[model samples]
Target chain A: MTTTTIPTLPAGRTIKLGLSRIRYEVKTYFRQGDAVFFSFLFPLVMLTIFSVAFSEQSFGSEAAPLSAAAFYLPGMLAAGLLLSGLQNLSIDIAGEKGDGTLKRFAGTPLPVLSYFIGKIGQVFATGILQAAMLLFVAGVVFQVELPSEPAKWATFAWVFLLGVSTSAILGIALSGLPRTGKSATAVIIPIALVLQFISGVYLGFSLLPEWLQNVASVFPLKWMAQGMRAVFLPEDFASLEQGGTWDLPGVLVVTAIWLVVGLAATRMTFRWIRKDS
Target chain B: MTTTEPVVSVRNLHKRYGSFTALDGVSFDIHRGETFALLGPNGAGKSTTIEILEGYRDRTSGEASVLGVDPGTGGLAWKARLGIVLQSTGESGNVTVREQLTHFAGFYPNPRDVDEVIAAVGLQDKQKTLIRKLSGGQRRRVDVALGIIGRPELLFLDEPTTGFDPEARRQFWQLIDSLKQDGTTILLTTHYLDEAAQLGDRAGVIAGGRLIDIGAIDEIGGAEARVPIVRWKQDGERKSVRTSEPGLVVAKIVAQLGEPEALEIIRPSLEDIYLQLVADHAAAEAADLMENAS
Candidate 1:
């Protein structure tokens, strides 16, 4: 007869499982050409086009001026973060749900937390790499100066982490909206595009109308872009920002709030299986 | 491998979706190392019962102990001892067969060898191929490989061979036979009576959210259902009669006809009993509905 006994797993096995999940996620992300294009290459191409088209322009006044390429670099970073954490992650999860992949995992011994950890880890790592590649290309090819000081790098780190976390969490929450893999793109792409435009990734925040700026400020993507600018741009260049200065505290608070809200919403709404499935 | 302690014991299990009752006080037990087949038609609450036992769904009110632990509160330790192959899982499409099996193995305390599992599922040649690229039958084998990879003591297979060719189905049966030989208790739900007859030592017929009948495969519908039918030619007219003792009936017919030609004795197959049970349950449900309407 088959004996029934609960066997205690060795210590640190959950960690091992999480690490292996991360490895699998990373491998799958790289293997899919469309995912790589959107997360990494697409942003670089956008940067190249923007730099070549508007290199001669200046964003702020003469005293603390910034090249268009330098000003656009931080926006590119924000764009990459949104692509990895929001667009790609949501579609991937929606596809998984539609195909019953998440349900399969839910039935297994693997903890649900481990699956989220793996997904978040994959997006975080890829988001960072995409940011690094964008920064490298902007510095080398476009002659854009990145954040050099330790404090600036620290600000960049927290902002990037919070931005990615908020986006990934919201992505997971929104993944529950699409009933099938085919509908995921239809649901997510328009939202992502609108968010990208309003958050000043495609156009400078200063160029947008005051009413548009007010609407954009309610979202984490705008705060993420502002925080990136605070790191990469000169202090006096804050003249170009709303209220005539970079509100560093406001950026932190908004991103943190979104992170908490997104986490809670995802915990409530995320579905492992599609309804019709 | 027989034991008095049933590996799975369920009693008064009830599952409801608002006013709709999926399972109404349905109950059964599966002994250790025994193959128990739950035969049911579509929408018969088979999946709900199985999912509840797998700890994937909440029951309205019931007592279900899988492997000595209440499945409602079964923890990860309890889950590790169970393997569940869902109806249709196409989620691991991006990963190769071998990669998927290797990853799932990490979740278990004592996983089978990855290569051995692949070979056992007859997917050794396709192990390196991505799941999406493999044929439907091959992908089902991958599901089975992952299901058995954990070396689960009690395996739950939900309509496992829904879309397999005859040859593939036979091959899959052989794979299940090997797992049975290893003393893994199996609880499976399938519409195929042949599959139930071939794999199940004991079988249950479920219809209209109730387990109406359950017993050994050969005697599922009771002694009356097991009665054999005797047929013979008499004066160029064909006649048949069902009797508990076919020998006596055949002897009587032979004596009356001088010699019985084209004589045949046919016992009720499992399929016959199953169909009768389902039909009876449907008729009872319709009658109940009519009485309530009045």
Candidate 2:
């Protein structure tokens, strides 16, 4: 055998590979019709249906009442982020694991972190597009007023980042729950739907029982919706909150906590090959 | 990097999941530039051994080394030295054939030209086609292309031609032959005994989680198993004799009985020897079970 010297591998190449992974991931995501329709367009469809159906209705206390479009806007935005980051990733990754994509990647020289970068990058790219479409429909088609104050926009940005980060990590961690690719949608959609309904995406948060409200508060979606409300609704509208305040700081804190928890969970559960394989 | 050093070595590897043993006390070595065929039936631990060597799965116990590094803790540099084609095709169907190869090619330090690999696997026409749209044999070609694009020193081909047509399988064999000429050490697992006979310099036959036999391709089942058998009908009785010189045996028989009816000499091929080996092992196992029961 001809003796060959193994080079000291470049440490910085992972980020480059990760960046390339994003391109393939985004391209692949748009090609899957089901994923494009459900994950990317589900929120817009829900927003349209609820806005037109309840055009005459208003939610919250009379002193701080908000129109249906305004009421559902924040809720749908939160749900959209959750769907893009958590629900989409969980199902997509589960399918990868089931179909041998993850197994193939595990055998290659590709870093595990690069695969994650691709996944999270796909979610972030699609999440932005989904958020934009939802907001556009709310602002023009439904005549819902968006936040004008730069401070409010600033709050929206952080809340959006935190929510997406937390949900995406949790999505990867939850991918292990489904036993097979065919079962992923069944396992993930129900969890996403339940979180949506209880987190006030489909109904008024304050209308639920106090006990249910407490239960909702324990998850990140409720805080995410509350944060979006702080951005889009009038400042005095905080009077209708469970605590009679938007609790913007609490929103950041809770979502950040979930982000940390999600990171830990993903570290423990993420696998290239299934246990049974 | 001595020429005598084995590229891969395993010492009494053992793996178990709960009560089921996947691989038990299996050991072998692949030298620098030889194609080593690992022949086995389904669930006989072929993939488990390959996966453990690839670092995709962990072994419960025993030591395994690939390219002088322990696979369980092999770094990216060590991994870059090897190419692997797993039993199952795993690339996403969404990406075009060329796109998938290009993506994987970026991961390695010394990668072959993507188009060259495409041609090598006979997928030049399907380069722009989405993998999902390709036929099963075509998708398998993509898997083979990806395996070679890394230009690896050691390649693991796990049942690579499982879905290929006869023509495609022949073309794949030629591709493997070229790789062999390049002095790339390969460890291949396949159900096709002809493929092993055509490509392997040496072989290891595994059965029921154990290495039943290991040696040069022609010598795997031992001399006794390969002895040519002469069969003839005499006095309404079927009879056969095993001998190294079937021609001499037939001459004696012809001289004795003036050409007895239904006479033939059967030269045991590798497939025949392999089957006999597996059957003998199964019979031994059944007898062991019976003995234990009593």
Candidates' DockQ values? 0.47, 0.45
lDDT of 2 by residue, B1-294 (tens): 687778999999999988999999999999998999999889999988998999887899999988888888887788888889988875459989999999999999889999889999998888999999999889988888888888999999999999899999999999999999999999999999999999999999998999999999999998899989999999999999999998998899989999799999998988999999999999999999999999
* Model 2 misplaced stretches (Cα beyond 4 Å): A1-6, A58-66, A274-277, B90-92, B230-241, B248-265, B290-294
DockQ of candidate 1 compared with the true complex:
0.47
Candidate 1 residue runs with Cα over 4 Å from true position: A1-5, A55-67, A147-151, A179-181, A268-277, B1-3, B232-237, B243-264, B287-294
Candidate 2's DockQ: 0.45
List the TM values for chain B, per candidate.
0.92, 0.93
In candidate 1, list every pair of residues with a backbone clash: none
Give the true-contact fraction for every prediction, in order. Answer: 0.60, 0.59
Candidate 2, residue A30: the lDDT equals: 96
Q: Pick the candidate with the highest lDDT.
A: 2
Tens-digit lDDT track of model 2 for A1-277: 4664566678898899999999999999999999998889998998888888887777656876677888888988999889999999999999998888888877788888998999999999999989999889888988887888899989989999889989999999899999998899999999999999899889888789999999999999999999998898887778779989999889988899999999999998887775343
Q: Is the docking of candidate 1 incorrect, acceptable, medium or high quality?
A: acceptable
